[model samples]
Target: MKKLLTAILIFISLFFFAQSRPEIGGNFIKSLFTDHNAEKAHTYFDSFVGSQISVNDLKELYPQIQGQMGNFKSILEVNNEKDTYYFYSDFEKSKLDIQITFNAENKIIGFYFIPHKTFDKADDKTALKIKSDDIELKGTLLQPTQGDQKKLVIFVHGSGPQDRDETIGENKPFKDIAEYLLKNGISSYRYDKRTYSNPETFNNQSTVEQETIIDAVNVAKYFKANESFKGYQIIILGHSQGAYVMPKIAEKAQVSKYIFMAGNARPLQEILIDQFEYIHKIEPSKISVEDIQNIKKQVEFLNSKKFSLDSPTSELPMGLSATYWKYLLDYKPLEAVKSIKTPMLFVQGGRDYQVTEKDFNLWKNQLKSNKSAEFKLYPSLNHLFIKGSGTPSPKDYEGKGNVDEIFLKDLVQFILK
Candidate 1:
């Protein structure tokens, strides 16, 4: 459900300047949005920048930036690497890294807003590839070195272009889960999402079948065919959006079990609206009423059955095509679950704003007749199954944390039992 924001704006002089003050940088950024006062902002620019870049230059640039990132909200975090400081600024739409260096007078001498990157670690894992047709995704297979491996978990990522670790800010929940499972003698296989690896292959027309399901089915088949993995029970673990589509994947892939992590029983459109409303309630300024109305109009169109292939993608919610929405409209998770005979473990974070307790309850209620269906509720955890307290927001994900230990212990029990 997370989207990546990218920007690269750099203006640096050949010579190095003095240490930059975070307050100056923060205020200057605030000025850009407050009044768009290029003339005033120019005064904070160092001599080198002032000479080369005029007020008109900033005027032209500020509008372009606001068009993409919306109004600047606040500076979330600042990291210093020697003379350079990277300010993780939160905008209305997304977060960006503002790299700046100040002159001796504390004026802005060098500045940049580059793409954010958080490095992944996988020393204990073996690199592999999961291929299907033209798509070949880079992946990792981790096996416990100490104990007998009788099972392998295949991780399916949530919506968006996710890397192998399902990285969010500094957190790598999948990697953390993989390592924890490895310690307990459980092997895991995770790969970059198709949209992440081969973005060119997808467009607005692409549905979940193309973006997620096929690749996951292929991964299960790949492992099942391997001689080494012959007798091991293959468990498919789907997170968030992945969890919503787990039943479809389970139908195609002959996995022994399914693990739905923060999965939703409600339709995606409903869940999306709920997420926006929750964000607006907690932080009224972050999501505007106009935004909610716009999304609702799109949701109404999808439910109305008036849209066809001719419908514009721009008018659709999340810019997904009419075909994509149609697919979701036709397929119901609850109905899909009825056909899934494979044992399922539905887990949800009590504090998860994205997929809340309502969705979990829907799953529990709908699947109550099924003896094989199990459920877990981590009351203190967030969407990522990471521990946190108080009101949950996007800021909650910024802090570094791992999946709850208790959930992992229970997962092991479910798998081994």
Candidate 2:
């Protein structure tokens, strides 16, 4: 998901630049992929980057595009014909559409790309201004087209920074869900987490309970006061880490129901360990048992305030940060959700290595033992609940697809029934 964020940010930045670039931005992109002289390519791109941006910035997001994308010979085929193509050039596929259109001046005027049906059409968001405790939170209000004010849903994004759309991997999961729900007449509210645009306020921080919990509370408070949704019982839809945090938020916010999409049912540490093990099995792998054990040692190294973000690469594995690993392990979802009173719908995807079948089954047992939980598994779906096959990888998500059809059907049923 982080990988996808980098790509989307780069794509968005390029899209914005394509509008007013003094030099043809399309040509710049083409040169980036096709040019053989790494130095010249690097220099050309550096010359155009805005003053506020650093050369190292794009490097973090698109090192793969600049360094590795142009290396491979890729094949494109239709019927009996075989066509060879390189990426970064404009092209079309059944799912992905990309192009650069021109104006009279021959400068790149409109660069367009569309990813089709990227997620479920969530119900439409109603516009509402939610006021709370000297803070005004922007709310994307959703209303069911058919149902009475008895049912509504709210969406909260996963860990890391997220907008209302839960933007990741170059896909807008929340937008897709919002669009889908509108068609089905299910209402929803997805808002920006307090952590965003206010990171400095949380920089020194307090107990790091899920920040989205605050969002969940605020949205619930919105539901409480809004005349349009006066009689409805609010449901919270949380994805990934949001799932971990939602139960507490639901209880505190006084919501009546909750949904967990691609959620985990185990301790975060165990899940992270599982994720590492899954990715370690990939060819040209970056994870190993030795690395895992070394990472464990670094926990002590980090917690004692001895770790440095700038530690030499020789001290640790490539791209592994002690500070980040230490921080991630602290979240405890299983503990948070236990004994929660609200009804729940737990959705899991088969191909999702980020959160596995094991975690799903644990949730199944926990929910089954209780009268309030319902479970559904999509065997071919990935971490995003998108219909998928085989192992989950960075490449799989690049191809366009919607969230699982079964998940959509279940969502409609959950609200309707």
lDDT of 2 by residue, 1-417 (tens): 999999999997777556543334434444433443333334333332323334454344244543422232222211110121112332322222223443443333333332211111235335455654445555576665574446778887787656677655445677788778777767777766555524444432322353556657777877877797777777788898788666667667777778888777675556655666666777335778776776556444544565565554345332344444444456555665766776788888888888888888877776567877888888888888877676687666565576765688888787666
Q: Using lDDT as the measure, which candidate wins?
A: 1
- Global lDDT of each model? 0.84, 0.60
Q: Candidate 1, TM-score vs. the true structure?
A: 0.74
TM-score against truth, every candidate: 0.74, 0.66
Q: Write the per-residue lDDT of candidate 1 for residues 1-417, one digit (tens) a residue.
A: 122222221223312133247777776777766778888888888788899988888899887887776787878787675667778877766676788887666788888875342223455348887787688877888888778668999999999988888887667899999998888899999998878767899887788999999999999999999998989999999999999999899889978999999988898889889988988898888898888998899888877767887789887889988888889988889999888897889999988999999999999999999999999899999999999999999888766688899998988888877
Q: Local error of candidate 1 at 371, Å?
A: 0.9
> In model 1, where is the ten-residue run with the lowest total lDDT?
1-10
Root-mean-square deviation of every model: 10.1, 11.7
